[model samples]
Target: MKWSEVCIHTTNEAIEPISNILHESGASGLVIEDPLDLVKQHDNKFGEIYELDSSEYPEEGVYIKAYLPMNSFLSETVEQIKLTINSLKLYDIDIGNNHVSLSEIDEEEWATAWKKYYKPVKISKRITITPTWEDYSPVSSDEIIIELDPGMAFGTGTHPTTVLSVQALEQYLNKDDLVIDVGSGSGVLSIASVLLGAQEVHAYDLDDVAVESTRVNANLNKLGNQIIAKQNNLLDQVNLKANIIVSNILAEIIVQFVGDAWDNLEQNGLFITSGIILNKKQLVKDKLEQQGFKIIQVNEMEEWISIVAKKVL
Candidate 1:
C-alpha cells in the first residue's frame, strides 16, 4: 500500500480551526504534529493544555497530513483554513501562500522514515523496553519489564498519564487485586499493573491498533496470559468486578466515564486517571467526587497530573 501526505504552513493558533475545516472538508484521519516538538524542551500554554515542545522541529515550517487519494480534500480544506488564519492575525504557523505537496511512499517507510522522533521510554524502575526487532534483556532482580514494537500505541510510558498510572498501580495494587485497565493504549499500564502485583488484568481499548499493540507488548514481556487485552470501550462489556481501574485518557472522556468507572469497581476499589492538563485537575476531581469516589492521591509532573481515587458508599 502507498500513502500520500499534504503539507501546509500555519501558526499554532490556526491549527484547530484548520483541523476542523479539514475534517469538515472530508478527511478520514489527521496526523497533527507541532513543529517545536522535535526538540527535547517544551513550553506550557493554558496550564499545559496547549503543550508545545518549543525548541524546533526539523521541518519547522509546515504541518503535514497524510491520507489516501480518497481524502485529499484535507489539502483544499487547509487551503481554505488559511484564509481564516489571515483574519485571525496568528503568526506562530504562517504558511504565507505556500501550496500543499503530496508524496507517495511504501507502508514500511512510514515507520522508519517518519518515526525518528519517538524513542523507547521506561516507566519507574520496574519497566524496560526495547523494540521487538531490537535485542534486549530483562534483569531478573528487577521488578517489572515491558517490551514493545515501535509504533503509535499509547504506552511506551513516555506520557505523563502512563507514568502516573504505573506509579498509582504500584501504590494500591496487591498480589490478590484484580485490575481492569480501560483505554489500554499499548498495554503498557496493563502489563505494568500485573507485574506490580495485580493478580489478574483485563485490559480494554476502543482502538484496534491499541488492542493489537497491547497484545504485541504482552508477547514482548512473555506474559501473553497475564494481560488479557480486548478491543472494547469500557468495563460494561466485561463480566468481572474490578478491584482497580486505571484510565489514562483525555480529561473530556474521563468526565464521561466517571459514573461507569465507579460502577465497575469492587467496593472501595481504586480508580486511577491521568491525561488531564493541570488546569482541569479540579474539574475532573469534582466530577469523580460527584460519583462518590473519594480522592486518595494526586501526582503532578510537568503540568500534567494523575489522580487515584477509591469508591465509597
Candidate 2:
C-alpha cells in the first residue's frame, strides 16, 4: 500500500487546532517538528535516553506531518484540510506561512518514520507518557506510565495542555473519587485518574476515532475496566455527577460548555481545563467565573495555559 505524507508549516500557536483539523480529515499518526525543541532544556531526572537530529527541523516556525492512505479522495481531503486551516483565522490564530506540501512514500517507510519524533518523556510529577514502541521503565515505584499509540487521535499525553491536566489531577483528585474526562483524547487523563486512585472514570469524546483510541490506550495500561470510554459531545447529555471534571480542549469550546460542566460536578467539585493559549487565558477564566466557578489554580507551560476552577455553588 502507498501513503501520502502531508506536511504543514505552521506556528506553535496553531499546532493544536491544526492538528485537530488533520485528525478530523482522516489523517493518522502525526509528527510535530518544532525548531524550539532543539534548544529547549529537558530535565535529566526523567531520562534523556533518546537522541535528536537538529538538521531535520526547520529554521523557524514548526512543521506538522501526518499520513493519509493514498486513495481516490486524497486530493479532495487535502483541499478540505486547507480550507479548514484558513477558517482558523476566525479564531484569531496566527497561522504563519501556512505552506503545505505532500509527498508519496511506501507503507513500510511511513509506518516507522514517526517513531523518531516520539520518545519517553516525563510530563508531570507522577505521569510519564511513552510511545508504545519505546522501552521505558519508571524511575520510581510511584511513577505512572501511560503507553500511547496516538495513531490518528489528537492527544499524545505529552502536550502542555495534557501535562497540566494530569498534574492538576494529581494534586486535586481524591482517592476513590469519580472522574469525568471531557474530550478524553487517547484516554490518557482517564487512565491517569484511575492510576491516581479514582474509583471509576467516565471518558467522553465527540470523535469516534478518539473514543476508540482512548479505549485502546486504557486497555494497554490495563485500566480499561476502570475507564468507560464513550463518544459524546461535551457534557450535553451528561447526567451523572462527578467528584472531578477535567477537559484538555480549546478555550473556545470550553466556554461554550462551562455552564454544563458546572452543572455536572458535585458541590465543590474540581474542574480543570487546558488547551488555552496565553492570550485567551483571561477569557476562559472569566467564563468559568461567570458560570459560578471559583478559580483555584492557574498553571502555564510554554505558550499554553491550564485553568483549574471549583464549582462552589
Q: Report lDDT (CA) for all predictions.
A: 0.65, 0.87
TM for every model, in the order presented, reads 0.71, 0.96
| Residue 298 alpha-carbon offset, candidate 2, angstroms | 0.4
Q: For candidate 2, give the lDDT.
A: 0.87
The residue pairs in collision within model 1 are 10-93, 11-92, 11-93
Model 2 lDDT per residue over 199-259, tens place = 9999999989889998899899999899999999999888988999999988888999998
Q: How many angstroms is residue 244 displaced in model 2 relative to the true structure, after the best TM-score fit?
A: 0.9
lDDT of 1: 0.65
Runs of candidate 1 with Cα error greater than 4 angstroms are: 6-103, 106-108, 137-140, 237-239
